[model samples]
Target: MARARRTATRWWRWRRSPLRRRIDVAEAWVLLGAWLLAVAGGLLAGLLTTGTVERDLDRQRSERRESPAVVTTDAVAAADQAPVKQIGARSVWATVRWSTPDGSAHTGRTRVPPGTRAGTTITVWTDQRGRLVDEPLSGADAWLRAAIAGVLVAAGAGGAVWVGGRLVRVRLDRQRLRQWGEEWDRIGTQWGRKTG
Candidate 1:
């Protein structure tokens, strides 16, 4: 019962009260609208962003393909840079040659296992044009990216709505304060003369 009374009193601006000014009602409406928009708009934005990201990732998976390539030079001898850990193996940059479906040959530098011997065959990723490219994101990776993007976009949308509401509330408070000051001045003048 006490909690119910507290909740009811919390909405005093919406109740019939002579002390409740027009500004108070306007502020109440702004609060309600802001909350509604923040929830609905943020949800919509997040879903749209997530879907778009997922579709793009799916397209990448469809457009990229793996091809066999032969290392043109010994990785340990040709690689001037230190090996880096990739795909659970220490890799060094080495030139590799591959052929496209049209029997055309292409060579590009790619990461190969350290100490890879010349003429060793390795799998490499390539785009439709036969240019070397990074491996397409797996299903789990794509979902994680989409989820992160959705969360960030949702938070941004909600924050923007909340800031807009705060600005409106601040403006209303200033207007109320100005009106109070004016009323105080007018009433203070009447107090100069005694009623008795």
Candidate 2:
């Protein structure tokens, strides 16, 4: 049937066909290389990107430190601003004081629950200079964050590589088309120009 002939002609580059030209063989090789690059290169790039991301996150987790402190005074209760439907007690700035391991006193203003009274023992994280800082991420939270980052990095790297392969494929296809056109131009004149 016509379908059988179409299928037979489709992969002529992979078979012995008298009509197949040098360009056909070149295109087949180019396509094979493109596929290899898309798969192997993409995977390599994705894995490297993922490892780099996870290591950086681990470094950051190590750099951050944690400490405990106490609220110095009762936090001023925030005024209920009309037209604003607040979900929870709006946090208010309050002075909190804590001492270093050497008993050196330090104080800083930090957000506290509204109406929090002074002397309420509360723990607060601090930095190298004992400045108030957010708590370090827990182990589970860090893993979740790292996994999401890895997935995004992998997708981005793979997409870039896939696009590069497609560009190469398209260039090969254009070259093949131009070569076919040139061959046709040379032979068509033998048929009386336009064949009219």
Candidate 3:
């Protein structure tokens, strides 16, 4: 079958044949090494990136806590703040006050629903010292983010190896072409001529 010939041709570099140049054997080894590097480097980079990102997110979640705060100013509609399109309930910046675990009061500006009046209690996230902070992602969300980062890093590593291998192969092909061209030039001029 045609497949049998194709299989044999694939291993031609290892066979004894005048057509097999040193560069051909070297190209085979280069390709093999490139594929191996891509696999090994991709796995290492992916695991390292995923672990670092997940650990950082986990640390953020552990250091932040939720608390209720009282808004001291009326919130304006988001439309009034800007002309940009917004989805869901309109929100605005309003000053809020909350107490720390040590009974110390702290105030900061945070986003609240439009039309919210003074003295309305709203849930907020804070650091250990009661400073207003953004909420952290849950474990599942963190894992998902890490997975995406890992995949991108893995793909990048593999792509770099593939590109490097292609460049090497192109250079080798040019060398072989030049060699053939030189031989053909010498042979073309000697047609039907005898030299002793």
- Which structure among the candidates has the greatest TM-score? 1
Q: Candidate 3 on 1-196: residue-level lDDT in tens?
A: 3554444476787777999999899888888889999889888899999999999998889999988899887775433665664666567788899988889999998988878888999999999878888899988999999999999999999889988998999999999899899989999899858877
Candidate 1: C-alpha lDDT: 0.91
* Alpha carbon deviation, residue 182, candidate 1 (Å): 1.4
How do all the candidates rank in terms of TM-score, highest first?
1, 3, 2
Candidate 2 stretches with Cα past 4 Å from truth are 1-13, 73-86, 89-95, 102-109, 193-196
Question: What is candidate 2's lDDT per residue for 1-196, written digit by digit as tens?
Answer: 3554444466668888788777678777766776677567666766776677667667666766655778877775332332453567567677889876667889998877777888887777766666777777777777777677766666676677667767777887898889889888988877765645
**Model 3 clash number:** 0
Clash count for each candidate, listed in order shown: 0, 0, 0
Give the Cα lDDT of each candidate: 0.91, 0.72, 0.87
Which sections of candidate 1 miss by over 4 Å? 1-8, 82-89
Judge candidate 3 against the unseen true structure and give its global Cα lDDT, from 0 to 1: 0.87
Error of 3 at 96 (Å): 2.2
| TM-score for each of the candidates | 0.86, 0.70, 0.82
TM-score of 3: 0.82
